[model samples]
Target: MNFRQKNVLLILLACFPFGLIAQAQKKKSKVVTDPVFSAFSYKGNDAIYTDNPLKADEFYNPILQGCYPDPSITKKGNDYYLVNSSFSMFPGVPIFHSNDLVNWKQIGHVLDRRSQLKVDSAGISAGIYAPDIKYNPGNETFYMITTQIASGIGNMVVKTKDPLKGWSDPKKLNFDGIDPSIFFDDNGKAYITHNDAPDRGKTLYNGHRVIKIWEYDLQNDQVIPGTDKIIVDGGVDITQKPIWIEGPHLYKKNGKYYLMCAEGGTGGWHSEVIFVSDSPTGPFKPAPSNPILTQRHFPKDRKDKVDWAGHADLVEGPDGKYYGVFLGIRPNNQDRVNAGRETFMLPVDWSGEFPVFENGLIPMRPKLKVPKGTERKWEQGGYFQNGNFTFNEDFSKDTLDFRWIGVRGPREEFIAKTKDGLIIKPSERNIKSNKVTSTLFHRQQHNAFEAAFTLKYAPRSATDMAGLVCYQSERFNYVFGITRKGTEDFLVLAKTNKGETTVVASVKIDTGKPVRLQVVANHDEYRFNYSTDGTNFQNLGGTVSGDVLSTNVAGGFTGSLIGLYATTGNDIQPQ
Candidate 1:
């Protein structure tokens, strides 16, 4: 069964235990608690520095690092705006603004409100798919279109006048496919392109997808019927039966319509192809040199090869140069996909009819020259800065940082920041639960790093618990928390793999004082430690393998996240 179908079955099974009469009368209690926020302390050695300090000409690859995938960029005058898919994380669709395209700062999220994002039933990688951002000069508004698979809100668009402030509510559209994109012609006509399932009797093989387009009627705010057409079926060569031709984007240049898309799925064979057409909906011709961008041909034994390079979007730099931003994976030890897919930037040369990446399809370089006259400036908020540094968050501010995110839509009352530290009210939804919970987490940017937190919470019962967690998903994760059993409090170390929970170790601790929990991750192994005085820590459990928490092993599209969480157990009956 599909994810939505399985979710329905799970919901039915969840309600099957209670009888009809009990279920009819049962009402869940409104658990209200102070908002729980966290302060992060980061220390790392892998800092990026430019080669030419005077000119600031060179910059590092993966410009917006760490699980930022399926990038869509649009240039508005001198400022460039970009957005990426969030996929089950709250505050979806992070919007970034940049002047030189080398340095980007996250301005805000397009879907920050609970009403805009409702992915409680969405799996780790099944919530928000590829998002496309565009700005309409005619209307003077920014538009973002994406598909929320779990919520069944197919092809929705959200707009805003000022991206720094907030975005408007989602305007659901009637589109039949995923990865929806908008293209505005110079004649003031708008078109929507997406990847749709193969038509009946047209599929010679499984996974045969087509790129379709339809004219969007902004007047009525709907896709106009009878304007639907298939621009590229399968791929450039339909006889070869290319698989998964998706992420279609239309660009108009020099009186020609350019349709760019990714082909051959999102795996190692992923690649970018281009097509040109005289009309927005027509018999487009593929570029002579197809698969213009990819790393699939790189030698597997190459030390610094990047895999899964596709789903690219183009933007013009400050110096009138074109640049491409695409998704690529930097595998860890044993070829494990731990960091998830990251955003990589490459210079685009456009002297030819069709634009091509400067480096062709080879592995992206570690360092490249930035656009001329590009200056580096450190701005506040969640903007990434290269070079060895530390990020210390005390949660003294009223708002959470852009780097911090929760699963699905966390309840507002479940999180708060106070003088004593961040307070999180225990919820019935534990880490193992697929639903939303009071768990605030940030991505694990480095393989070798330490995440330590001081959680000060007194458990009233055995059910109330709070601690630090290295979470991959509901199925695979490790939790180190302080909980009470009877009148005694203990520091607990637990692991949940494939839906089975096992308590590895538990140590009786004094509940009179606060607890400090730490998890040190070195490549593949993680060690858990705890302390009462916050000066010294004692190891509580044996080393845990980080492989089980990887995307390849855990079967998710997200990277590992280290964060603070609180749970009241699942046995709490409805009020």
Candidate 2:
């Protein structure tokens, strides 16, 4: 009885081990075969087709998307670098890099340090204005010239070894004017050009439409006196007409220095013109084909409808496509003003050795050769819902994809996580403050979108509050949060826009230990729902009212953002 039974039981136990091993292999094979595991690939190996013939699906072109104004692009070999106006937004000069012009990814901000730029207290449009980017062939370095909009007369220069990292401390050029550009000549001379008055010390006598260029001594790092000359003066030219001239970029090609300047205004009616001369200090003649690009007069179907275009820069792609990155705005077509100005790229066309553009057709298409792979692209809006954030029970380290950004700018202090959950720390100030400290937030870039989040918050102080936010700018943002005020819990709704954020709703937080907050936004309307328990939700209210701040209002050249944010307004000490 003992020997036979023992042998049979041992065989059965051994069979169980082999069976478990086979089942484990089958489970692994299933995961490898799953569409979500493979289709959610980042390699972009899969190819899919879009109705967009213009290749608009790649790299979130309109990369600067809405109103990311005064774009400056510098190309270094196959790598392209970009920077934009962070006006009033902290962490100025947000820099990005793209190997393929169509697929851009932000590496890190160049002006993360406070010494780099100063935007005092996010007031009405006062900060880094119109940055111009250039590369030197001799030294193989990149440089940026930026204006302090509120400060008036001084412009700063910051250089970088890598465009992704922090830039050198700005070497202040005490020269008075705005829209400054540095032209690096083949002869190894650096020249600075900016808006200068024709008649100095005289108020009405000075023509505002004139732009002057002068040989600058970069070795000494100063604007040279008397070396300056008026390159383009609108007071003289009549038939070859242009209204406002600013944001100049100088590049020499084929024995002529091309002076490219943005005209009209940044408003929806923006335009750009190019002039050529044999010298950097030019008694320049307008390009045989003047006004190389202008969106002020797009076709009936092409009109952006909102004002402001043309703060542009020319970057030669790795494939040698001469591309112009410029900013334009598309109205939400809603009664409320959509303040976002969309950025567009059109190839610079050379007609008879001069740049020519197809009438009002600023090419809004991607130029990169589609990578040789299966084309699979994800839509910005969800297939089932329209929100910025998505969450699930599957909380792996991999659940957080690349779709998150910190408010004002990104910082290590703003984010943290464990295997269990994600946590965001409250920054001391609101978006309007100079501290660049806002509850860390990411953009809600879609017109119709939904954002959802699942989190547990443990606040040490009554002022501690963390939740999801749909923010257009400092003044125009709405947040849904569970805050601790004394022993009482305060559910808050803060509505801000047009330099004012009125607390529209504040109610007693239900006492059952508030843990999770979910806010869903569709178009301009927002709905707030909360859950003390993960399954059940309470509708707080949609009575909160504010304009969906776009490029038009937030005052930056960026789109609206919806992301996780935590705030402790004025409760903590300044940085």
Candidate 3:
């Protein structure tokens, strides 16, 4: 090696240990009881789950993480089981298991059956809506009810033998509902409650503005027809409100049933309300302290116009503490919203027969608390999706985590696992799945991070190519690849979003040799580079802004993903 090259390697290695030290020290950046707001703009930033330890723990109220909306949880012994809305994301209804209500891990999904809904090629926000997860020990089956919103339809139920696998086929309830929740009576009879969307039938006031609850007969396995009754009618409060009341979950405390739901539009900062009922079917009334949880309570986010925080589910913690989980948004910019709508948690307090909500914002820094005999693996993917799982050794699971999702519905031909690593076969498909063969990928979480993968290419023709990409949309993103021209190898960086390209270098190398590739993606920007000798590095001068993956502009049910791809070229077809 040249003297200059050797010196550069020494400097890079010498600086590596310092980076690790900084990370260790920065872990506690937010340790205050009430964190003072930092004067930083929210624009172009990634999701923030941890309170800046340096700032204090002021914003740590909501314990659960990610985009877990409309949480429904049940207590079994000391263990807490939770599930939430998966929308169009496949393997829907993520099931989470926790002991303390603070620390939770995903177990599996509930809607594993095809009868519940067809998801093979479903569009964004098309599949399952909010779902309520409940357990019936008498029948020893877990029940789930979700609305398939794409078809403008409502309510389907499924049961499972074990928490991890083998769920029964969907049993359609055939109601024009949006959110369906289940409540098990002490007498062992189960009841169903939902927001009724009345058929307008040529009237201005058509959709059901009322929340209904009724006796559900499992023997008949359907809503007890005609036994349905209105528990809470919005009356004047929800008039002209299109977002309306949805995501109803029932929790009986003392002698009252607390029907907690999300109201107002799902966007902006003006959402949320909690009500109570003396009987399962009531003259349900709003808690005197209504709108129990709202972003209005978070002084900092309120000043900037952050919108929407509702759709709550309640569960008694192992310590006999009451807690609630809901959906909330943290906007990236004041003018535009991106991938927001995250799962949040808070303590639930009861005053007399009513529930009280204080500390409107989430806890500044949240920590997970588990049971004595519990294992971490079981709680990892139980309710929704779990992201930020690290794999230093070989990947340890047969199935993927709820954290892993694709840009579009992935086909069997686009992805496979070879002996060396995961093989992503490319197709003519655009990143948006417009064509159907783009092999983009992402880990399911709201954290800013990066990942690296190794690859080997065997191109048959000059046009054949293989490489890695940071994918937000086929119309918007960047890619770095190794393409063969005749017998020559070239390093190219292409910005798909802007339609720009800049080739870094070229070398005459054997096509049969393996190439190690790496992608360093900032939650704010992306940098890609490749290594030929496995020691020297070559920088590809291209980086795409992370905002390209934002949910607002991209128009999808998920955030951006990182993946590898192989596409057709000159005339080569390896397979």
Could you give candidate 1's per-residue lDDT for residues 415-503 as a string of tens digits?
76688667776778888887888888877766566777776666656677788888888888888887777777777888878878778
- Per-residue CA lDDT of candidate 3, range 1-575, in tens? 99999999999999999988888778644321110111111111233433222122133333444455667777767777888776655456778777666556777677654455465455545677888778877777778777876444457788775777757877778566668888886768788888875434522343336677778888767887788776766522555444467677787776677777776646544455767667777767776666667764555544223346677777776656676777765454433333345677666676456665445544223333342333344234343323333332122345554545443243344555444555555554433343334453443243345455555665544455666665555555555665656556665566554333334334444445555566554445556666666656555665645555566665554445555566653122111
Q: What is the C-alpha lDDT of each candidate?
A: 0.80, 0.59, 0.57
Cα deviation of 548, candidate 2, in Å? 5.7
Could you give candidate 2's per-residue lDDT for residues 1-575 as a string of tens digits? 69999999999998999999999998864431100101010111101112223343333335444335678888777778877776655566667666655555666566666566555444535677888888887787788887876544368888877775567988888676788989888888889888755555433322246687777776766778878777877522544454567888888888888888877666655677788788888777886545667655555344224335577788765545567777765454343334355455655665456665433344333323333331213243221111122323322565344334443344555655555555555676655554555354444444443445564554445556666566666666666665666666666766666656566666675644434565554445656776667568776766443354654445544556554656666232101
**What is the clash count for each candidate, in the order shown?**
5, 43, 50
Q: Candidate 1: TM-score? A: 0.89
Worst 10 residues of 1 by lDDT: 45-54
- The deviation in Å at residue 225 for candidate 3 is 3.3
Please, what is the TM-score per model?
0.89, 0.74, 0.74
On lDDT, the leading prediction is 1
Candidate 1 ranges with C-alpha deviation above 4 Å: 1-39, 45-55, 379-382, 570-575
lDDT of 2 at 85: 73
> Local error of candidate 1 at 498, Å?
1.5
Better of 1 and 2 by lDDT: 1
Order the numbered candidates by TM-score, best leading: 1, 2, 3
